[model samples]
Target: MQKVTLYTKLNCHLCQDVYMMLMELTLETPLEIDLVDITHAHNSHIRAKYTDRIPVLARPQSEVELEWPFTMADIRAFLSDPAPDS
Candidate 1:
């Protein structure tokens, strides 16, 4: 299974769209999604970094990230690539 983190914010249509894509992809792919709301005060640093890049999909413990405007094919490609050793 692939473990990933999705950085997002509330009321973001783009984020919602990505979430739906992830959910649909889960049906065929073994994915573990960790939804992180950058809006929370606890995630201030993350919020600052992703304020303009909501709905970013990233591999856990890896720097690889797929930003918004990505398609299902892109997601599949991203997941197909193995995460680099940390």
Candidate 2:
């Protein structure tokens, strides 16, 4: 299964939207999502990397990122595309 990482923060409306969209997508797509809270890991370098980009979706193996304000079509396309070689 494809691995999806969501970099987000609590009480973020955009993050909430993304979460809902991801839940809906999970109903049909076969992707495993890992939700990370930047606030809880504030000192971590990963948190710094996505500080201003909460709600970002990343396919670590593919090094692909889908930032917030993304549409369902964008999510669908990302899921359909082949993961990039490591």
Candidate 3:
């Protein structure tokens, strides 16, 4: 299974749109998602790193990150990309 982490903040329209897209995608794609609100997170590192990019999707274990302004086709390609170690 693929692991996805979402960096988001409240009241961010882009973040909401990305979230909706991911949710809609789950209907046809099988992947687990973790939503993290970086704005108020206890870990300042994450907040600092993603404040400008609210809607970031990352595969932590693989160190792969996908920023916003992405289409469904982009997401599909991201998921299909081979893992770094593979």
Q: Which candidate is the best by lDDT?
A: 1
- Give me the overall lDDT of model 3: 0.84
User: Which candidate has the highest TM-score of all?
Assistant: 1
Worst window of 10 by summed lDDT in candidate 1: 77-86
By TM-score, the candidates rank as 1, 3, 2
Estimate every model's Cα lDDT from 0 to 1. Answer: 0.87, 0.84, 0.84
Question: What tens digits encode model 2's per-residue C-alpha lDDT throughout 1-86?
Answer: 67788898889989888888888988887778888899898578987888888889988767789887789899888877787725
Score residue 51 of candidate 2 by CA lDDT.
Answer: 89
Local distance difference test, candidate 1: 0.87
lDDT of 3 by residue, 1-86 (tens): 77688899999898888888888889987888899999779999999999998689888677789998898888888877886622
Residue 69 error for model 1, in Å? 1.4
Clash pairs, candidate 1, are none
TM-score of 1: 0.91
Instruction: Give candidate 3's total backbone clashes.
Output: 0
TM-score to native of every candidate shown = 0.91, 0.86, 0.89
